[model samples]
Target: MKPAHRSRRRGAPAALRWPAIATLLAAAFATSPPAAPPAAAAANPASFAANCGTKPVTLQGYFETGFPGTVELTKLFTKQYPNVTWKIREDPFAVITQDAPLVLSSPNPPDLMRTPQITGLVKDHILLNLDRFYKIFGWDKFPASDLEQLRVDPSGRPQGVGPVWAMGINYSMTGVFYNKALAAKVGIKLPPATLAQLDEDMAKAKAAGVLPVEQFDSAGNGGLIFPLQYLMADYTIAASGSVQPINAWVLDQPHATIVTHANLLAVEHLDQWIKDGYFNADANAVPYSTMMARFEHGQGLFIFDGDWESGNLDHNFPGKYGFFLFPPLKAGGKQAAMSAPLTYGIPATAKHASCAAYFLNWVQTNPAARALNVAVYGSNPGGPASLPIPPVKPGTVTAQTLAAGRVIAKEDGAMGFIANAAGPIDAEAWTPAVQKLFGGQITPQAVLTTVQADYEQELSAP
Candidate 1:
């Protein structure tokens, strides 16, 4: 059964105007794009009006929305412009459904919102389009694959193109985190290298009184589930070399298959695991910390979450924490491909477009910030972390991190999409389905009724 969680999002307030330096584009440039794209928009980086009344630009946003990189960005942002006072708000991921309508309509709509690549933001027209801006400024500093990942429509356009909205500051990849001691205690000599083998290992662990896996709550800690779902989809995609949408952009594309039978096959695999007790009974209700505890106590063998959990592995699980890909169904799929490293979201009313863009651009280039951020997020070094985690591990998530960098120098952004970032469907809609699939309340077929219906509706809606 799913565990009890706190999905409450009662205090999610919209953006409040600040009294700092907010660069007004209209006044700044005589020739900047008049409004959004297709207006034969004026060029960006347009000079702001000297009359640019420097107001106290109060940035309304959250620090805990995505991964450690975004969190790192927040820290760096405060330092960049000490004069800009911030009224930041951090809330649960489910709040997208909890308070989306309220904030979208309220007079004091947040100047900026930190979302997890949600769909409704586009369907409801709540977010500013950054496609033109990102291109003009060159967010392509990373990889083409990474850029494509940002464009979840899978039809070959970035999420910011038009109806798509909300780019990421950063995102983590999904993977399998395991405790070596638990593997030994359960009499397993090796971690499974394939999805089938993973299931086999889980069954063995369960028979020996160990929980095969520790999955977080579908409510409060739900974002952690992305890895499991990601893997399931990947298993099928590997066979076909196809990408599915997690956002609504798939519908916008002339020809895109957001929900295919093969895609549904992935959901079925997860459903079978949940039904067979691979996860904790309280999997749907357990918070991330609680699941981590399971691994620490050596009662659980593995974790289905992001690579960002690496730093916390040692102290949390204690004995030995190792990482691996999602265990593909196909023998040799590029298991190295990850969901995302991290991406940033720039606001329409950003006062420091140049500064923000520069900061983002600098983040990709600067080693210190990227290194520091990777440490905090507990993720392995990707774009730049070429070596490995240092030996002197600390108790905090930051200390047990990798030293080498894994920065995507070639820039291949081909991440599929996060359901939250995909379509017009509210991110929460998948929860009940995910829950039902596990609890035996519904079959994967039943769950797809909602999943497919939503995917279709979101795709068709204006």
Candidate 2:
């Protein structure tokens, strides 16, 4: 990104006003001011050190439900750094992902916020570089992958485009989960990497009176739509020879790069799945829980799910089921991928940066923290292999899974970064476009045509 573009990303004016506002709030309500007893009294803004401890810092923390360790971290951060109180801000993960940039771009930027910030944030220059904070973060103490995951650019190269805002608070992967017993009943193996084979198995399962797969649609957007992204990634990787058809968009932002054959093929596969009854006829409309509920009741023999399902299943009986990464759709294809929700970094102006450091440092050193983090949030920070403490029921995602993902990252010469998570490419176009394609309302060629046309028509115009 250019220097001028970088400047525009400066949280605008709303970001600049936050410190003053936080300071006033802290001072005025130090004692938790009484609720509107009479006329409103003006409050003074609070002040704090941008670095840590020494100067009073008011850290604005953003987190999602089930994001383990944050609430505790806020408390610990305050204790560790006097005068540093974290204004804990929690929201639905999706809302946070979609609007964090807008919120951050506002005048009073978050001093310290959390979200699964995407690579685009780094490309756009909205994050603080933690290169210097390495010493503070005590990077040497943790596994290398975990340390690198925290960096915006682990390679320290600009071309790679790294994470600008968050560290992995929790990690989860999307894949196919199946009932082992049912697989046996259906006379098939588990997690068929090839969808053609899975289709055959599904036919058998359906004949056995089971919904071969439980895939929700838009109403359950969080899981299905998101899990589908991995299929999209695989398609892009196999067809385009690159992700998002980078083309010249790296240098020119006005015009988006074009789509590849595999991109359309992936969408087509999804559409076909819908048509074949392998997925919901209108999966977009059903809630994820309904699908899971069906699967748990043994109404469904197969379920396309991920690690997060484990937590919900464990707490609630989702029947006896086993899981694995969603195998590749193509025959003789590669194994499943590490499609994650992603994590983020902190900004330079973060009020509780130093405090975050203390907690982050603790993240590296403590096993108990890791265990609690996993059980509470269903995340595998670096990888199951790199975990300081072994998570209970570390099923398919063993250290080996983490190792393979790392190897893929190393060999592919780049870790995957989701385009939507980055900046606004256009949710309206993206979701609707994919949904239309998935529903067989369009073809692969048509999907690509739509993306290209949409990009040129909407993003390129003055």
Candidate 3:
């Protein structure tokens, strides 16, 4: 399940205020092509010499859930800098989101933590500014878009453009996972190329006496939000003529709101999917884990989830499932997907702050670390420069997932995950509003208006 968005109540005035709606719209629909990806650069491990002074160091750290890459990266770091030791702990995402501020404020905060709830953490001055580190490591070599995910204004709100406050260890995207065996059973020879074709395939799956999609709604909005946001991202592009506006809105840019026509179309499409019997009848009753279990057990033809599940799916199903981007609404439309960084930041009061910075710097340049991120963790290492494209092994779901990430990167097709916008806008508003729609208690239009109301309230807060 996605973690709930968190907002900070105590902060100086926002460093980046909301942009005017007109400005946001113009930028979103701007026709200019994105800049070219930069050439790869060699990392200077020599620059880290000053930080690795002749002192014995034990670095304490925490991470959301259990990302094995953290352990692998830590081990790799210590091996290279043998003077340093690591004491790492793990916690569930919800717990981390709620407790990070308190933990960071303590006199003995972990030296480093996987902090995805950056809006609140940045605003509250819990994270150390990495400006000097960024300069030393030449981390600005990363794609501007990749770096933007880590930037926040001085007031701590996510500005999508400003000082770098954090960096992502892995890149993740939202996409469609299908049961290859079931696809064959339903006579689907190739993945659908358009939304209409996807709907047709879903109809076939339903007719073949299988659940068309495995989704969960019991604990929260993962079931609804994931696929719906995928559609919302695509629809935003189709409506506004580019994905920039949607990214702006999702990054909490000034004047961005959820009550847009694209979002309305996304919700309407979801309602139509439900009415067409594309989802499980027990969708409202099942949790996301159960849904994945059901999908892995071959109870559904397809599942909507993130790349984080790729490792699990590969282990359990092997060649059984295939991963693909969600087909566009129309032929040749943008192949938009929800994406964000598996980001981490250092606490200002961290005891071994330099060691933490060295580790972050090492992640992007070390081929072994990047491979572990992909092969073991099933994540795209959002490093400064691209790694050699791994050879695709046929029938490997992870290979396909990495391929999808490459496409997103090459095409500049990632839009922010909707829930990353704000707490009130997503967890407090969209989640329940979607549940209401799923339960037949409200309409798609109601979902739009309700979320917009909460978004406005959040922006207007003191």
Candidate 4:
């Protein structure tokens, strides 16, 4: 979620404007075809032993504030390679999105920075093309789907083909995190298997004076988008048997639209949830942190969030929470969730690209680093599918989220965040539209039409 600080750097280039960036991207793709993936032998594990070299070096990084997993991983990296230290800068997710193009264009950019949307940055020739690193590190060995989200075609669309631009320290998944004690109070013997059962449970919680769901809908962040997208995925799958339409829309495929019948049904469901008071009364005012705090304090029965918080919940409130994918529409039906990497990339002008690439590869393959990813971030350390997941303690929230991630993988139900449909789609479109829905100012159909209109305008900007 973007914070209130949405300022851009002074005197930034006009070319950096998102619409202009899109135009430039289309031009680039038309004239110069994207390079094919490099061919190389599998990277040997022993090769990483000295990938960073013996000389003293310091890596510059820009990371999202409040997530300690990346910083903690950097410290671990330095521990193994004492000569390599880090000088890091931090910002909230929204700030990073606004600043990414400017920073990547700077003469002195961070060696490694958190990447937001790639379509613009890729087309502007600001982000380093990691096709070479892919071969050098034998990243091809990882599951194809694991890397697909990071791939972009010549047309700047994410078709899971073409050169790889970034790599994930760990892949994150999203779902429902419920307070276990509250579940027993509501007589929910097990997590709901169907949406109807979930609705029934939330009604029970409300009857018992419990907040049925604690989600944030604050302007800019619009945390409600989580459940809305989850519902869209469920409805899409129920109708079409796959999430490709939603994924294609998010990947910016030509002629893609979110105004389908399934999506309309999804929005109507969320509108009903709003009308039924399933969400917090002050949801529109709550931010991500406040919502998490409220849930942790037992102020609500459930929260929709990503696996990134699993470790924090396990550590702070041990044995108090349980997680499940948003229930499917029918018993034993397929499930889906928003899952993507905490992507990081090097600037085209970065000074230590090689060492930075080494660090990225190590984060996934090194036993200690992979363990830190699981233990600290509670995410899958994405590497070769053959590399077993680090053992998680039973009964921990991290364990449940990890298990849920496997369910998503097996079902092929992963969908990118809908907010990422375009550069400003989250803040300028979905956030405002959904907030209006919560305020009873807009109908369910209006929510879809409004966002789709905004999406078209942004993508077609001159």
- Per-structure clash totals for the candidates: 65, 30, 2, 0
Candidate with better lDDT, 1 vs 4: 4
The TM-score of predicted model 4 comes to 0.88
Candidate 3: worst 10 consecutive residues by lDDT? 36-45
lDDT of 3 at 313: 79
The C-alpha TM-scores of every prediction are 0.69, 0.68, 0.86, 0.88
Residue 37 Cα positional deviation in candidate 4, in Å, after optimal superposition: 28
Compared with the true structure, what per-residue lDDT tens digits does model 2 show for residues 398-427? Answer: 332333444344434222333332234335
Q: Model 1 reaches what TM-score against the true structure?
A: 0.69
Each prediction's RMSD to truth: 12.8, 13.6, 14.1, 10.3
Stretches > 4 Å off in candidate 1: 1-44, 48-61, 65-87, 95-113, 118-138, 149-167, 217-231, 242-261, 314-319, 336-338, 341-344, 380-414, 421-428
Q: Who wins the lDDT comparison? A: 4
Per-residue accuracy of model 3 over 1-462 as CA lDDT, tens digit each: 233222343433355334455578788789667532232221233444536566888989898776776788888878877988888889987788778877876777898898877777777676777876777777768778777778888776656866887878877887999988889888986578988898889988899898899888874554698888878877877887667877887777888777788888989999999888888888888887798888878888888888888887787778888889988777877787777888888887776677788778677667777777777667677666655643445668888888888778776788877777764466687678878888888999998888777877775675
CA lDDT of each prediction against the hidden true structure:
0.52, 0.54, 0.78, 0.87
* lDDT score of residue 444 within candidate 1: 66
The better candidate by TM-score, 3 or 4, is: 4
Alpha carbon deviation, residue 63, candidate 1 (Å) = 3.0
Between candidates 1 and 2, the one scoring higher on TM-score is 1
Task: Report the number of the highest-TM-score candidate.
Answer: 4
TM-score computed on alpha carbons, candidate 2: 0.68
